[model samples]
Target: MLKGEKLGAAIEAARIKKGISKAEMARHFGVKPPSVQGWVKYGRISKDMLPRVIRYFANEVGADHWGIEPGDPYAPDNLVQLRPKLSAAEGMVVIDRLSVQAGMGAGKLAEHFPDVIDNLRVSKDWLRRNATFTSMKNLGLVTGLGDSMEPTFSDGDALLVDRGVRDVKVDAVYVLSLNDELYIKRVQRRPDGAWLMISDNPSYEPYVIENGDRDHFQVEGRVVFAWNGRKL
Candidate 1:
């Protein structure tokens, strides 16, 4: 039987065997006293929470007498519980890749031609939820670097860039080729044809493109989705 079917039995038997009161057991698991009582009354545990309940029993009691087995594969892995991805709603898609050595904060990124070395597979639904533009042809993966936008986007993060969005839009993050150096910064359009290139972190001062400075800056693309995880 699935672990859910036997959760109450296992917990009840384990508690009775250990001679522990409901209050003490509730305290150990960080649950309300009524919750523990409910578990005994209703054997069924919440499907999503079952895995954690299963783990707690094994680690604390080391009792195999419980019907539920150890290392339950049904439990969602670390990524599922922790990162909470946007999931492949309709299968997956292959996206163009730009490595750290070429893109990111390493140097001036390609303005005209892209050297597509590899591809990244992601849930198409993730793209659908994030993308504003329709064309997948302009989609490319970029490696993020530095802490200019800490707690927002950070170094070693993965960014999904839409090359089609080369126009400066209000409060949008853009990848730019400035003075032969590639940098990712937020842009705000001013009334006088001037613009402000901002960093989320106040430590890095904002840059102003005073109308005349337009020639020095080029919009490479707009960053759409930022995947904050290790680049594997």
Candidate 2:
């Protein structure tokens, strides 16, 4: 069955071929524009809504486009399984790995807008037991750069970032952008309604953003997990 990015690509291709706008599709499905974007971007949809999605597309672009037998819209074998078996192990989820890197030293400019470079498959049970996230689709992987976050996470570490966190909800490590540059640093809200961007290494001085200068700072996401690549 077509799943993951493949499924997303298929849906996008059919939508484009049919000349259907995302807003129009959302209205047809009784969902918001972002929900349709999620289906096209992450290839995920609720199981209960799968049948409707299949039928809608099948009718719009014809069943031949999706390799479904004619007149058998509900055929089990032709169904597009949203949660496909990612690995040999069952109950696994795929998290997109972004091509962009988050610098832990002096900030770096993103050469290009971030794109999905690959997918990281992890056990659902492990994710539920370890990570505190609202949804699996919001999680992404990025490689860390520089030694500013050493001892906690060295350079070249792989980090799990929650893209859904666009603001500093609590004092924690976050992937943020300052003056158009990207950085991974610990963020703390100051008592005076400002933000303190701190590096773990003492050599680098903390930077503070006052309320007036808040326009230059933007929280990209929250860093939840780090996989250190240090050798023993």
TM-score of each: 0.54, 0.63
Q: Least lDDT summed over 10 consecutive residues: which range in candidate 2?
A: 79-88
For each candidate in the order shown, give its overall lDDT on alpha carbons.
0.63, 0.74
- Can you tell me which runs of candidate 1 are displaced by over 4 Å? 1-91, 100-114, 229-232
> What lDDT score is found at residue 42 in candidate 2?
78
Total clashing pairs for each candidate: 0, 0
Say which candidate scores most in TM-score. Answer: 2
Compose the digit string of candidate 2's lDDT tens values, residues 1-232.
Answer: 3566676777888788768899998887778999989888878877666555654444235444444453554444434332231332568876766666889997888633454444567889988877777587789889889999887888888898888899887999998887678999998998899999899999889999799988878888888888653321
RMSD of 1: 19.0
Clashes of 2: 0
Instruction: Give one digit per residue, the lDDT tens place, for model 1 in 112-227.
Output: 33333345667767668766654776787887677786667877777878878877865788888876677878789999989898888888788799999898888878887787
